[model samples]
Target: MGRAIALGLPLLVVAEIAVFVLVGSWIGYPWAVLAVLAASFAGLMLLRREGMRAWRGFIAAANSGQHPGERVIDGIVGLGAGVLLTVPGFVTALTGLVLLFPPTRSVARRGVQRWTERRVSSAVAGDLFGPRKVRVRRGAPDVDGAIEGEIVEPR
Candidate 1:
């Protein structure tokens, strides 16, 4: 992921810049600027709305003694959208707008959840039982008809 980010960020920046220039050329520069501004403003409004909704849902879930995971996830995604919208770029703004919408946000939420789960599982698996190894001996006794193994202490 880190390597992908290292490579992708530069390409993303170049693509965004090229898009901006092309848009500016197609429509007058002033109009292009206005369009970007308008998109940002709209995104901000969407961010605020989604943020409020997520907050309210969180509060309601908490008050009702229910798990707030979904609400919290929504709030986090909305916050991300707000940040992206705040950034002065068309690509980020469009991405933010997509995250602001419920259908798109749900898709993004699932992706985020899956990514988080994978990261957490890997982290847990990495530090399991303080570095241990399994050893299979040729004469090991079987237990309950299951293959037997032993933990090999570090030499």
Candidate 2:
């Protein structure tokens, strides 16, 4: 992940710059600048609205004695979308808008959930998102199942 980010960041910047230049050439420099500014402003508004909605949902969940995990995840998604929108790039803004809309947001939410489940332990994921059904496979009984490990004492 770290390596991907290290490479992806630069690539994203290059893509953003290229897109900006292309758009500018097609629609004139001033219009391109205005478009960027407009996107940023729209992002700010979305951030504020989503932030409040997330906060309210979190509070409501807590008050109702329900797990706030889903709300927390929603809040994270909203925050990310807002930040992406605020970034000065068409690519980021488009990605943010995708997250903002309901259908796309749900898709993004599921993706995040799946990613989280993969990265986190089952126990932790269960605590956050509730229990998940897991499939267990039986190995051959004749095969040795003992594991080997070496524990080094700290000097």
Among all candidates shown, the one with the greatest lDDT:
2
Which residue ranges in model 2 land beyond 4 Å of their true spot? Answer: 138-155
Model 2: per-residue lDDT, tens digit, 1-155? 89999999999999999999999999999999999999999889878988898899889987987767678788879988998999998999999988878898777777787787778986887776766664445555445774434322112
For each of the candidates, give the backbone clash count. Answer: 0, 0
lDDT of 1: 0.74
Positional deviation of residue 76's Cα in model 1 after best superposition, in angstroms: 2.2
lDDT of 1 by residue, 75-149 (tens): 778888987887667888888878878899888876775455456653442232133466876775667666667
Which pairs of residues collide in model 2? none
lDDT of each: 0.74, 0.82
State the weakest 10-residue window (summed lDDT) of model 2: 146-155
